[model samples]
Target: MTPPETQGQGSNAATPGASPAVSLCVSTLQHRPDFLRAASALRQGTGGFLLQARDRRDDSPATRVGFTASKKIGNAVARNRAKRRLREIARAVLPGMARPGWDYVLVAKPGVTTIRDFALLLADLQGALARIHKP
Candidate 1:
């Protein structure tokens, strides 16, 4: 007899009657209407960013995120910096916490968004998402 098959016995393989691990996927919202719609749902604030969430009542399987910074934040350099911070925090926090068919808008807050500590900013995004998705 040939050697017992060990190729299917590794930890990564799904055992009998065991469910496989699911991967989280996130996407970016592009259209103007998408941003307009997400503005109407839940809103949460932290020291770094303001988060707005809207649940799209559809059959999509990915979460969508958006970022925005206002002129009030500052000149071109400051506005871009704030947007960059928001984008980084969103990428770090949104995948696992954000549910499918949801749209999230991260608006930069002047004097706070760019200067906030990176760890705190990440935590803020996570906390805001927790509150928004709470039942």
Candidate 2:
């Protein structure tokens, strides 16, 4: 029920010569044990949040990440917002800097993660990652 010319002109349609977007393959950590292990391994604190990382030392080559916001952040809505910010920062920064077979957890700060400037949050994550991976 659509004309040919308009059929392929949807917003998501790729341009004729534009290269496809390249997205890194990253996994989410869902197990409590995984988070606990990472917590016990390495920790880097930033103004926005706490970054915890652990090398799984397994055969898997995927980088896994987790986000957490405690009740101290506020009620449900505030906690969710903090976690959302953490997830976004992880998504943007982890792909390039995170090592394979590593698990990372981003814990939201009570007053920072939900309201901090986005660029600063990005820098915070990047710096934390650098310090964590340093020898």
Candidate 3:
């Protein structure tokens, strides 16, 4: 039996006059100062977590994001789980709404971040982002 052919699978199957999809560039924020600076900037709280954002005002054009879960969230395992959820939500939502040259931090809430519904967490992140970006 022959394998079925798929569209846009190989480089040789290029379509005429078609533009490739563009993906937003994003990077992870490291260093304590970056997180502190964002913490002191705009803040928006949602049911799932706290969102902090700051504009770097530099020439770089990539959005940076950081996730943090403190002891208040729980022990090591719980903290890790909370951070993982934050990272997933950021991955799903940040690409569409995050602004270039801005740094964002997602702070996990105790007893909330890990147990909240995934869809609601996503909505919370989206709402928080919208609030922080609003003038």
Candidate 4:
């Protein structure tokens, strides 16, 4: 697959002059049942976010991810901002960390979801995924 178009910082494409890693085919988990499945699977919480991941033992060749922010996080704008930050971090990190045929959900926490430093948030996510996937 040609690299996905970059909107800004978290571009899906590999940087120039670097050989690309295995391309990721990630899908969005939109159905309620999908999210429910992830909710019942392995979970890891970091300082920045909560991650839930499940093996979707089906024939699909792509990993799926979902994002959610509770109403208590804030009003619509704040919730959206938190979700957007989660999405960007997923875009940048999931290709490297996520396994195919798994469903992952990212739930935004209250204060750190939006205001935390991006690099730290990325590290938190990477750490969470590592812990979740460990044998």
Candidate 5:
């Protein structure tokens, strides 16, 4: 994930094409193992540099997003919590912070999902996205 400071930048202009509002959200890791595997292999394409306001893709119509959490976070409970937290973030910011044809992979930070304040977590994630997805 990008640092929280940058999330706000991407929060705008992230409409149906470049906005987060139109991005797809998937919470269940089991629903798409193939996609999970593919996502795991993803290197930082454009290193989040592609989202920059200056270099941002002007023609893209959608964004693709993926998430990953390893066994290190904890048992099923811990992992699930992390994903849940991330889900909330995607639901909150993705709708308003991303562009179309964007594929985002929200990797779980250590103990991230375990945090009880989901709203805070979501804000942090949004802020980070804004920072990372900058021009």
Candidate 6:
């Protein structure tokens, strides 16, 4: 599919000339201070509607993915791993399967995402998105 209009840096969809990739996952998220604002924007932009027959906000323009890792995961190294894992999942799963608009947030869970298998991480992301995107 064609890329969406660019609205500045906020426009993080896959670039046309570049190889296919999820420009950014959890598109609607911002710094923690902006979480409420981001959520509000996503809620409105996606039309306050959900698409999944499971009623999981499936019709929404952007699907949201969150990540959060606690201290037990390890020190900074571990945390980074978690973030990397989340990013990889975002990279692999979001480009083709996602609906037109989606907000994918990768919260850090100490060091979770970093340690997971690449294929499994990707599959997990797909499962999450599929549950919410349209049929």
- Assess each prediction's global lDDT (C-alpha) against the native: 0.86, 0.88, 0.91, 0.90, 0.54, 0.50
How displaced is residue 20 in candidate 3, in Å?
12
Candidate 4 root-mean-square deviation in Å: 9.3
**lDDT for 109 (candidate 3):** 95
Best to worst by lDDT, what's the order? 3, 4, 2, 1, 5, 6
Question: How many residue pairs clash in each candidate at the backbone level?
Answer: 0, 0, 0, 0, 43, 27
> Which digits, one per residue and each the tens of the lDDT, describe model 1 over residues 80-132?
99988888877777767889988899999988888889999999998898888
- Tens digits of per-residue lDDT for model 5 on 10-119? 65634555554533532322346535443544233221111111222446564555566679778988888777766666777777776554456666756545654666
Candidate 3 matches the true fold with a TM-score of 0.82
Reference-based TM-score, model 6: 0.51
Query: What are the per-residue Cα lDDT tens digits for candidate 2 across 1-135?
Result: 976666558886766986553346588889999889989998999999999898889998888999989899999999999988888888788878889888899999998889999999999999999998888
Which model scores highest in TM-score? 2
**Best prediction by lDDT:** 3
Model 5 local distance difference test score: 0.54
Clash pairs detected, candidate 2: none
Q: Model 1: runs farther than 4 Å from truth?
A: 1-23
* Ranking, TM-score, top scorer first: 2, 3, 4, 1, 5, 6
Q: Which lDDT tens digits does candidate 6 get at residues 14-117?
A: 55586655454335344664443334442211111111211234465555544445577678777667766665666666667765544445444333355556
For residue 68, model 2's alpha carbon misses the true position, in angstroms, by 0.5
Between candidates 3 and 5, the TM-score winner? 3
